[model samples]
Target: MTKIIFKEHDGKEHPVDVENGMTVMEAAIKNMIPGIDADCGGACACATCHVYVDPAWVDKVGKPESMEEDMLDFAFDVRENSRLSCQIKVTDALDGLIVTTPEKQF
Candidate 1:
């Protein structure tokens, strides 16, 4: 399992152990992390699972794919590091990944 951190808009931190091959959004939903609505259920069809990859981990997480990028156009508060949590698969290399939720999910 990989240890990932989800920081809420209010500055709350939720640390969770995510299984290999699981998406980041799956971990947040399983752990009850707030701000990750995941309305599309990791389908990459919606932006409710939007998150800003911690700047320090951006390189490791890499950029969002074209489809994910297209969906992100509907996200709130998009940033250079903004990504759809559903698009980020957990891996051993991302054991310490950190992501921050936006002020709003819509």
Candidate 2:
């Protein structure tokens, strides 16, 4: 399993072990990590699951695709490291991935 760390805007952190191939949003919901609503599931249909991937892990996590980028336009406080958690797939390479959620999902 891969371990992913979800950090809330308020500095709270939730660490979870997730199987490979699962999306970050899935891990968050399954582990009850607050702040990631994932209103559209993992379909990348909404920006409710927006997160800011830690700079250190950005390369491993990679950039979002065009579709995801478009959806991210609706996320709050978007930055260079901003991404839709649902667009990030968990993998062994992402074992220690860290992502921070926005103050509000909308």
**Best candidate according to lDDT:** 1
Q: What's model 1's lDDT at 21?
A: 97
State each candidate's clash count.
0, 0
lDDT of each model, Cα atoms only?
0.93, 0.92
Cα miss at 54, model 2 (Å)?
A: 0.3
User: Whole-model lDDT for model 1 versus the true structure?
Assistant: 0.93
- lDDT for each residue of candidate 1 in 3-104, tens digit (9 for 90 to 100): 999999888899999999999999999999989999878899999999999999999999988998899899999999999999999999999899999999
For each of the candidates, the C-alpha root-mean-square deviation to the true structure, in angstroms, is 0.6, 0.7
Query: What lDDT is reached at residue 70 by model 1?
Result: 93
Superposition error at 97 for model 1 (Å): 0.7
Residue-wise lDDT of candidate 2 within 3-68, one digit each (tens)? 898899999889899999989999999998999899998888989999999999999989899999
lDDT of 1 at 14: 91
